[model samples]
Target: MLNNYPLLAKVESPSDLRKLPRQQLKPLADELRAYVLDCVSKTGGHLGSNLGTVELTVALHYVFNTPEDRLVWDVGHQTYPHKVLTGRRDRMLSLRQRGGISGFPRRDESEYDTFGTGHSSTSISAAHGMAMAAKLKGESRKAVAIIGDGAMTAGMAFEALNNAGIPHGGLMGDLLVILNDNDMSISPPVGALNKYLARLMSGNFYTAAREGAKSVLKNTPLYEFARRFEEHTKGMVGPGTIFEEFGFNYVGPVDGHDLESLIPLLENLRSRPGPQFLHVVTKKGQGYKLAEADPVKYHAASGKFDPAVGFVKAATPPKPTFTQVFGEWLCDMAEQDAKLVGITPAMREGSGMVEFHQRFPTRYYDVGIAEQHSVTFAAGLACEGLKPVVAIYSTFLQRAYDQMIHDVALQNLPVLFALDRAGLVGADGATHAGNYDIAFTRCIPNMAVLTPADEAECRTALTTGYQHTGPATVRYPRGAGVGAEMTKPLTAWPWGKGEMRRHSARPQTHGRGTPRIAVLAFGPLLYPALKAAEALDASVANMRFVKPLDLELVVELARTHDALVTVEDSCIMGGAGSAVTEALSAQGLTLPVLQLGLPDEYVEHGDPVKLMSLCGLDAAGIEKSIRERFLSAPLLRSVANE
Candidate 1:
């Protein structure tokens, strides 16, 4: 069944795949799925969803003339097969590795990646834009968006569909949207709409009756009348009742894993016109037995492991990640304070709030994939004098920027934002990196931002944020911290002040400056900064607060030190570095300042160490950059002296 396909290995591009015989497509799909499983088993990535979409990706690429025909993938976690087929198979081994291929569709990476996607439910809007652009240029190229059923729950997806349904300047363009329904998000999708859609799609009688009526109606003399009757019948019986109202020609609940079904259906849709929606049913981890049995656990993975026993849990010294620390602290805080509530936008496990949800059922809210709602919900809770702790990823929180500014910050609500995965997140790539929170949060009027370098600091920061009356965010990175001993209950640290790890003694400038070159480090990057400082014989301060500026420390460092360097695992632009710059400007202290952090460009996926090095956030990289900047200072001083 898998023989006689020259296009399988010969294909260097999507165009090459398009040249194959239609009958051989099934074999190609099989081969592609196998290849994906092999690569993921070795490298470890988003396995389940990609396994499910192998046939769908093949079918779309085969039918569509990509590059010209824009295909925007929603969420992009499932784009492994798409990447492999689109002239990136050679680099598949290096998937999610630093300075290698990204896990998501990056516009800068290739022409095939028409739109960069990391967050969910964006494909339709992006594709709509592309379609509109094509129409404006008088270009006949097709624009297709492949989004998951899970992503469909997001308000943005519906908003896009609503806009796409309207005629383009009163004229609708050719845009095909494929809904890949795997019946699950990272966790099983929640909400009434999800349940309603699942029932409508999975109900055997509903599907059979709809298809049977259509089949009989096509043969009848009253076929047009029967089709209209069928549409009315569907409105009464079906749930995409809402989608029809959105002005889309809804097709299928079709078998997505079946290429025979998908290819013909895609071809038929391709021939037709105006905003097409195909609801294709697929299982996450369709081919892989182990993953199919347990989709959520295997949604995404890391490192090499045996397929037989499944992913082996690596044996290590017992130490909690910053996420786990936050989760424990949140639960403990909730136990102590009855008014404390928890909120997460579809990140139960990722944020480590599973136990909290179980223990405090009334207070915990999983607001689906709606980040905007999550923030506003927390704000509403805070309005009632209830402390709402929003446990969200730094990247995901970007979606709720307006809500954070307008609702939480403006109102000065006591909402504690537990920002997990705050720094360079390994494997998940640029989309998942929480690099901009420091800059974004600090800019807000009533917002206070704190970063925890170690596990203990994470717990303290959470307590500090919770105790604060205004909007506060405690940002921490992914993975294990420096394994600091977790001994006590939650305790609030001094607000807006920093802890000095080392004291200088050169002169009594601002404070005594004996050591010189005060290195202000924030978040998980502090470990490397400390190591670098030891090497350079410099003073170090765990500048815990991103906002409030640590005024006293800044003034002292500026007065005493010949040079000062600010280090953080966030974007240098408008980040922790920017915060320090703003603070120094306010003080009118212009001592040689070096801002070291993540660069302006997006950090790619790889091992955390490699990614840090690439962004100059590593110990060696940070020290070298600081050394180079200081080396240039002497020349400037000579010019000043002249």
Candidate 2:
């Protein structure tokens, strides 16, 4: 691979990259872009975004004194080229694997990775902090934030822009914000800002005239006046006016892929002072024709595939994902109920709402990358006697916590939150993991939290939550469950109730010299727990709802058995396990309770099954834990004697 591109092969680090002559950078970028596509194809990670940022990455490293000068990447999926140049080229094969490199930037990963990020619209604020720190310490350092056009839709990005553009205590910091306007953010960009940027890109006359006037009028008395006039006129005509209003010296609508254009502009900006904003236009998939044509499809690869042919359909039809089930249910429910409306925070495809959007355009709302607004928007819809189902990722719901409590739950609105990716999302790692939703939402008043056991239950849970007058959440993990039968109708489950799936074969010996143990499971982890139960001959109960837990069943299981075990996919501290312990304590029943779930520490990126096993949530792991905690030699000997 190295022999294919001599320039890229020699560049082990950014310092090594800098050693190459100026003319060699174009070839280097070409090599880097090709390498990114190659690596992502093999490893199954982010593809289009990485391919887009090749020249920009090369230019930034070439121009800036990184490690000393901080570069914070917003929506860090585009950092593959950055990673490749920063002494991790060889490790590209290990991307998102167990003990391998992360898909996004991690502060601990490298000195070049100044800020760790997984969510969008955060780069500007972090870079501003770094820039301000440099000012306070009196260090000659610069901070640059590279943000995507899609990320710019979020209010947080603008909030940072508002603050960063001005001075603190009458002192300014050297900060630069580069808008990598690929016009894509997982999904196609939306909102007024996207339109405004489109206009900015098309307003070539304003950009050309402004620059032409500046160059020709320099050293003349009218130059300063012309500059002021340019700013004033650009406000009405288009181009840089909005950014200039924020107090930054706005530059470009430059070619991001062209090394010649990107390098010189970046070099000039590197020497400038105060806040600077550069708008660079680039393609999502620059070199690859397939991805360039259909960026949304090639946003990220699910697994290894042939790059030449692009992604092909599997030979066998795969099991339907929970996301797909939700999408299908949403359409079916919408057809029945006129008030049924679906909302997503710029995740039309991710939450499986592409078909819904296609079928019911008026009822679908894609509110860009604003989680806080999505919840409040749903609440407002529900206020008008409409049933709004906010289809969002479980990790993203954390951003709208206050809105969830104050707007929806407080008002007791009929708003159902269909939270996808409810547990340890493998490749995206700890940042994208949905480990805390069960713990967070269950505590809120008027909020009901449901953990469905499988695909069939997921559909039922969704129906139940949507029908409830109060705010409710139904969280399911990413991808397919155990291929459970999902042929059931969209009927509501018994409210806040659970049913025993398996019972102990032995006679009920009420807590006296009995080795009988009962395992209560939540969500899809029930399947694994059932497998574990088979070995131990333990009773298994699918505790459906996490918030209004089945206390009656808990007490019954506790009284009949000598010990009880709780299993879930979320964090053990405040998860389903905690609910069981609390229920037992309230009922004044004490039995040995073993809680099993994700640990307190962050679980890094890996294969989902491997990660579950490592966390002791898989069948083998669960059985091993139950055996160690409950089925000791003394207990086994006593059971043998009985």
Candidate 1 ranges with C-alpha deviation above 4 Å: 1-7, 184-232, 236-238, 505-515, 631-642
lDDT tens readout by residue for model 1, 1-642: 124434467778898888888888888888888887777778888889999998899989998888888999999999998998899987888888777788899989889999999999999999999888888888888899999977887899999999998886766878988888898332232334443443454345555676687788787788888766656865543344567678776765666777766676677677655787777778989888888999889898767777667887668655778888888998899889999989999889999999999999999999889999999988888888888999999999999999999999998989989998887888887789888898889889999999888999888888988899899999988888889988677788898988888765443232223325778988877889888887777788889998877889887776667668899888888988777878877866666668898888866678887778877878999888877776434413212211
lDDT of 1: 0.82
Q: Given candidate 1, what's the lDDT at residue 454?
A: 93
> What lDDT does model 2 reach?
0.88
lDDT of 2 by residue, 200-280 (tens): 533455456766888999989999998788677645433678888898877666667777666766777777778988887
The local lDDT score (0 to 100) that residue 632 gets in candidate 1 is 36
lDDT minimum window of 10 residues, candidate 2: 633-642
Q: What Cα-based lDDT does every candidate model obtain? A: 0.82, 0.88
